[model samples]
Target: MKGVAESRDRSRSVLRIGGVSGGVFDRFRSIQDLAKDPSIHAVLFGDWISEISMTFRGNERASRTPDAEQVAFEMSFISALKPAIQDIAKNKQRVAVNAGSCDPEAMAKVVQQLVKDHGTDLKVSWVTGDDVTTQFKEMLKSGEKFPSLPSDTPIDQWGVEPVCAQAYLGGVGIAEALRHGADIVICGRVADAAPVVGAAMWFHNWGREDFTELAHALMAGHLLECSSYVTGGYYTGFKKELLQSRNCTNLGFPIGEIESNGEFVITKEKTAGGIVNVSTVTAQLLYEIQGPLYYNSDVTARLDGIHVADEGPDRVRVTGVVGLPPPPTTKIGITARGGWQAEVHFFLTGLDIAEKVELVKRQTLESMGEYQKEFTTLTFNVTGSVAENPKNQASATVDLRIFAQSKNPDIMSAGSHKGVAPDTPSFAKWVIENCLQGYPGGTPAMDLRQSTGKPFFEYWVALFPQNKINHEMHTFNGMTIPVPAPTVTAMYPRQQVSYDTSSPLPLDSWGPTVRAPLGHIVHGRSGDKSSDCNLGLFVRHADEWDWLRSLLSVGKLRELLEEEDTGKKIDRFEIPSLNAVHFLLRDHLDRGANSSSSYDILGKNVCEYIRYKKVDIPKVFYDRGTI
Candidate 1:
């Protein structure tokens, strides 16, 4: 129950903070529920803005008049905090969040108004300068290049021009805002863990060079950043029994109790639903991270040495987190209008599913004729399959999707079919005309609106010099504080760290093996970072770790996920403490979520698909039971 009041004395050991929101649509009740807890010193909100969101906000901003009211920030946070303002004030709790997204000034104003209307004296502050669009454009004009993260292709060669760009800020600005007596701090596009790191920094009065303490706080932020993610939301071990035994319906958000010695315990409310154990913590630790060294704007965290252990029923203690100076540059995401994209689906039922798909593809292309050449990208994918001796019609049906994108909107629009004949050059006309000519049991989906093109965006992520950003913090009392980039930074090369686990003993040493899905003995979590996907696979038992490390390599991963393998480079790393091996599949998500036609655009299900792939599992491991 150690709170902010005790932490201010500088002798107190722990600072407790609750994670209220993970993304744009997370539950609003989290804030209200957590703010009422006396043990909770502060509530952190991580409103993650993906590439598509940035593009959508940019388009929205462009469409507005000069004098029009701007509400570009994530308004859901305000709605969530409105009802909790009184409780938060009464408890004297602090608040930090990156929900400001594209507009922190406006978001801060709204929060200030809400606090005033609620008759509370909670001071609100905002951090800005993450928006580097103008500066980025100027740098581009000056012949400076910003290369793409995966391909290393310069901006000049990208073909598309960025409409909006935002640099990822660190926690320094947030800490500065807190130092100026601000109870609430709003920020635009700060790192997801910045709010938590800032809160810890302010509570413990940690200096900039407190790398060890900062790194611990950074990892704590990461664990709590995704809210229920560390509390079994996306757990791979969600079986029927587990779901029934635990209250999966109302999963609780996580809270971090960080000690002064750079160790912390992750737990949730005792009365709330969901389980918080080592497995959940390990799964989250391995989620969305690239390699052994997890880089943030403030500190480069060495996660390879970290250990997670179950302390109690709903508590997992994390320790041994090493810290290094951050890199000189921070990541910046640039969003550009790519073009128009459209898709049409045809249902394939019963036998000859493959033949039906081919027939539909041939007919649709032939019907489009020369118009097919106009499309920038066109794909024909047959998704799912019928079960042998299926009992139901739904189980016998699959989908044939024809996805197309073009720089020319007419090429993908339904209006192009207006003046054309049934066999003429129109995307919609082509699919509809194939009705009778297609294979047996083939029928076009009733929803033809997809045939009409809609604008899509291309997202580019790369590193930008942190010193170039106009990082500043504006306090509630009109005091503006300049937050400088780190003076000391290590230039770590962008390469996978070498580990002993990479060269494991031969497969025969593990004993006789049985052909089974990897998920039978292994648990995994997958997530997207721009176009690249990071898949972290782990085992519960120490004996199984060797088998997992040896069996799941870059080659093995490619073999398992052959359909997704784009011949792109894949990097591998290991975390021995967690008995995990992680893979970075470069350019795997097909230009990422914004423009990807992939069903699993975010790459969240990549691990599940890989787990479904049959692999050789040691008999002993298989006997232990499925994860």
Candidate 2:
């Protein structure tokens, strides 16, 4: 193996790394494609686990013995890496992944076996200390309070015990493994961007104090972390014309070329489909982020000053990211069994749709009588609206969904009622019995399986002291190294940075206004982090930046999203570099994806919903063109 200095001098100043997987089930073939590319130095995979996945894996871990061959890690990663191992070894490239959910040692052992099976000499390593479920429980018993991110409610007051907890490890351990000559490093629940940051750290020989470079690398990793997200997938500008012009059938995964100076260019394979431009990159930058300050386990990145530009076709350059000291603590996710929940849907067609829904809701509640009080949450939601003057039966139909949850499984159980009266039926049965006594044109959905209750998990995100984590890296050569937490750190109080977009004239001063969808001149992307939702909206021209920043205030957003707004706090910020206005809606998704009964469980539809809303827009801006 060549030394760091020798390798740097021998190659270009840029380190090219490919991102193959965005989630656990992402395309497996991309791994082989990137591994065969000699220009790529390494491959990084992100999004292996969430709170719900952790809960499922925690149960699996609890049920399994220590000597179990098939432990609780992402098994799909093995299939993805099997065909790519020989290519990776032949090309002399490295690989890093967080597919080691709850168990990195087992994942590493599996990879080592694959390497041996393929007759490859590539070394394997694994990072530990991320699964701190036992330690977390011990701390809780010792009066350590882990406050929930959505509501700041302490664990004790949560009314449930956590089954598992995982700390977000940084890139230092990964870099240590790479430095010790490990060609592959498997990790458990590290920060999503840790692999990219660690690979860059090893390539550049950067220390923990190299804040600026680390920050830039952090943003680079963020862009590549979601794979096709930075390369036209889920892009707001994905229109029919763009689709017709470009082949998006098999979208390519992204590649980040990080320079020694910290600036990086994002691009994809030449033979692959999908487009990479400023808009795609900017859309991804705003995805799942709360504010201008992007907190990573390694560094706190200030994104307000970031600059993105189109360098060439299928390439975009990102720079000007400011870095602050690492936070003293990192986010830890704790998972607990929430309860049982179930729902039944009824279809209402044609005119008098609202009346039909009301009739059914009244009947269902009346039948439940005092039994309704036993349910923790019971909601009757009417989704969609009938079309005016009916074009077809399908278009004129709407769904009235009845969702219920309870701590007592019997309350939501699929079996006949046990406690309340033997004559009393299940929740689904109560609703279905009303079918004969229902309103005009009322029919229950065919899917009766969903009427049965299913268990769900609640996720609590809180900060844990980094020093408490037993961060370590174990190599194939039997070397174990301890990775230390950053000594230099800063505490940033939770405060929103408001941008002054005051205009000398009023909003209507531009010209005559027309009531149209906000998407006519705006593009947006929204995503959920726990229960909070971040909606990022941007415009095409620089001239419209001030108008956008001024128009989409907290009050305006609440007004636009009035139905979804539950009187929760909303944080607003501006990214002037991208001509974007971002808003964070706190406590928006009913306890997040796992326990959420909302139609938009992941909150990905919030942007489209807001964009579809009709709002008064400057006709001049619309004249330019719709996004």
Candidate 3:
């Protein structure tokens, strides 16, 4: 708490931020919320999680419709939150967005119409450069050829059918809209992180590859893109306090304070219904993190040497973001045929949670044994969302869940049919007499999805620098500000240098390139650690790669390393050639998740192992490994 107050060095001139989140569905709500503020220099949206857009325009008859999948994407962000955005525009507050999902072309028309209806002099343009579904089809119709990824097979053989095909565009497309004198810019499939970063770059007139400037924009965008995550939305325990303190219904939007190094701290406007604390920020830092390296389509911002300090009240200052060059390839969202997947959830509240779960498990297994079902697969769970270990408590309750999948229709039908609930002895007595909707209501149908397509790094992220993506856009009415113009700039493009998929960009993420000076290169090494202590760090994007390099360059980095790793400056060593190992580190103390740079929930020993990497020190070390 003491450190939280001193977190922000007021002497510094960084454009700080309020908060951030990774969920894509907040686009509409965020826009609606922030739109009310005329003081906002600009607005930007970074979304990839949901397809609110497909819902807004009311997609193709179910046959060709893209799945909503509960994602919070742009299209929905805007339409759902239109009233608030209009109020912002009327107030003359500047805003922007890239929440169009894969329908930028259609979204473009929507924006023009929306602006016109508002009767504000706000000129609007829907930016569409990456989505080439029509272009690809036209080419195929006329016999032009194109090569597909992996196989490089001709378009005809690839059998490409995109309900939406938006190429991730960058600053160039954004600038295109600005040049046309558009007030609100709309884009589809741009990098989710790019819109806000682009807005900052445009607002500050920051150029591409101006490492620090690029870092600033990247940092700002990162903090404000997510709606409530930064502002008590997903805050654990903190939300209880916020809800108790203020109206939970009026959730606040995140605001950011960005610096030149692309480091930012998030805090909402005062009296807002959210709490900006270390846990919320750090949770997001570790949430969905692949590992040490984090990537996205536009740039890779490294978390090395990263510091997050809560600066009292609502301020949280963050630093040490490393930036590197972007990769040459782009990541494609390939939803390949994943077959049929379905989930069912039910609550069991009468008795012991464990007891209830065991009974359900036993019954389901027994049913499977009797039928020798060929097309059914199931795993029952006691919780929801991301998995967590169950804890037993008195009168404990549980939400039972079942997941199943199959490819054959007839064989699957043998498992369970729809329009009727499955009756088993454990729950059969409860269901037949008083059956409700949620318990095994329908037969499983074959669901198909292509894999999350992996694209190259060249695809740029576009932003409509005019609005935030919001889910509950009605909140914009609270503020009477008018939204203004668009602002944007792209991160430096990835340099050409490689071919290898063995190393993925971090983990779950399928993107982006390792930046030059930071990504996919071989650099300095210790003659001591190995013949080649030289390592290759592939982050999710260019920003992360660059940030890693910066962390190693800090004045205290080498001094600290020398004292700890044996009186020698291991980072000072150099080598003849560095292939794909991105950058050189004079002294890098690479470690696992328990690094002291992060929250230390572990005992003191593990803390020291993270802080000093000591076998034994002033304090004894107790490792999680030991536990």
Candidate 4:
């Protein structure tokens, strides 16, 4: 295998980093910090949208109410300046961000509204014509049909919820956003490279036909997207304190200074308390990245052109990046409701029980025969209590999954306890989803996804064509309910309100300005039986604060808006940090360096040492302050 390594030379250098900071969206930070210095030429990458951001007006903070995503995005434009609107006023520079999440069309209008409110008659461009949710329709209309993500299997046998589907389009769509004389651009689901690509393309007036140069710029944007996470946040050597001063709080965002040749250095703010050495950058460069070679929504990059070296205490420069030609077909995400599915579990076991299992299942089926016929279909698969992932945990490899789905509600009532329980496994044990709350009756049929209902597959990246890229955001104006109401307590005199900060409510239960982790729902989803899944969350609140306090409190507010176990908090990581003790099985379970990523498929390097057994990763990232 090729060893983990990097090359340090004079040519590969980072003079500056282009970045958009703050929390969730770019609201938490201001470009003024970087603009004050001559190093940075532009600001980039602002994520707009979170429970509060899209619904409310800010990233969840300890002391916040909530606002709207549109408001948050508009506010970010101000932060990217010497003075509010000054950069755009002089036509000096600007930044691009995914200001909208699920709906781009609405995002356009939101910006248009903001501009109008500003009393400026800017000829805003509302770019549309792309929606992955209707990928099937687009393909049909274009006189072609193709499979969906990953394996892209024929849709004839699959049910796909076009929840989020769009190819990685460069910022070209925002071309119109710029051409209309709009200083700011808002897009949805554009590839991470799109903003940088769009800005460079429009800023330099590069044509769509220049594949080689655009590819280079696109590659640089890919390198800058994760900010510190790519730099020292996920460095390879933390033992020397690379992670010591890392302000999880200040967590520096990424910055890039692209040269005319397409090479760019990814770095962060000065005195930022994080390490930006070659090792740290090299690790970041390798993340989620496929090979020594680099790939982007636009082109395949020749990693060989890249270079790295220390320019100063915290600055590490990058240079030598080149890109190849683009692909042919476009990618799309079409959501035509997948069918319905309901599952009821029956816990049963015998010391020598494989034989008894068949008897019990057959008996249950006979009774539900009518319900089964009504539903149109029934499926029976078995495994372990850990019914989903088929990893190393197979000690008890016998479990059953009874699933059935149908278009009609009357037909869905088929798998009822009234239908399957009385028939077989008379002493049939435990059941969920079917026997609704103490009262055994038919439950509402849900679209139980095969990926979530069970542990199933491995992880892989699916790269699609670019023409399918759309950068539009839509806002569903509704009184979003809190996951679990933030148990409120008013502190009148001091102007304070206390929230549980651990709101334990499902995404659907979310209240205005509050949302569960991004793609959290996708965690429980099983891609296949053989893949081990790791779970984590990235929450985005769309709005920005007029003052500084808003950025400081998103984390606190998230906690406050949440109730105990009512929601997942960043503080859930307490086991090793809060104590000085180790458990009997600590060696086997810690996710650090030795223990497996429990269920992590993203390849997150969370734990330090377990299987090999140690409190710290021997040499990687460690606190130098302690030593």
Model 1 pairs in collision: none
Q: Model 1, residue 477: displacement in angstroms? A: 1.8
The C-alpha lDDT values of all candidates are 0.84, 0.85, 0.40, 0.40
Candidate 2 whole-model C-alpha lDDT, 0 to 1: 0.85
Ranking by lDDT: 2, 1, 3, 4
The Cα error of candidate 1 at residue 77, in Å, is: 1.4
With candidate 1 superimposed using the best TM-score fit, by how many Å does residue 13's alpha carbon deviate from the native? 2.6
lDDT, candidate 1, 284-306, per-residue tens? 99989988888988998999899
Model 4, poorest ten-residue lDDT window?
521-530
Tens-digit lDDT string for candidate 4 (1-627): 012121212242322436664235443435545444444543345544322232222121111335533322344443443243333333334445665544454555665565456554433343343334355345545745354332334444443322333343446655434433445555654556667776655545555545556766776666566556555564434445554454544555667666555555656776455656555565444443322334444455555346666787656666655555544433333323223445654443323334445654565566555554544345555444433434443443444556555544333333343445333321112223224332212232243333122111111113333434333422222211111111211111111122221333332222233222212111111111111112121111111111112211335323333321123222111011111111111111111111112333223422221111121111111211122
Which candidate's lDDT is highest?
A: 2
Runs in model 2 lying further than 4 Å from the true structure: 1-10, 63-70, 416-424, 498-505
lDDT, candidate 3, 18-50, per-residue tens: 222344544345555555664454443445432
Against the true structure, candidate 3 has what lDDT?
A: 0.40
| Candidate 4 accuracy as TM-score | 0.50
lDDT accuracy of residue 51 in candidate 4: 20
lDDT tens per residue, model 2, 520-570:
888899999989999999998898887888788888899999778889888
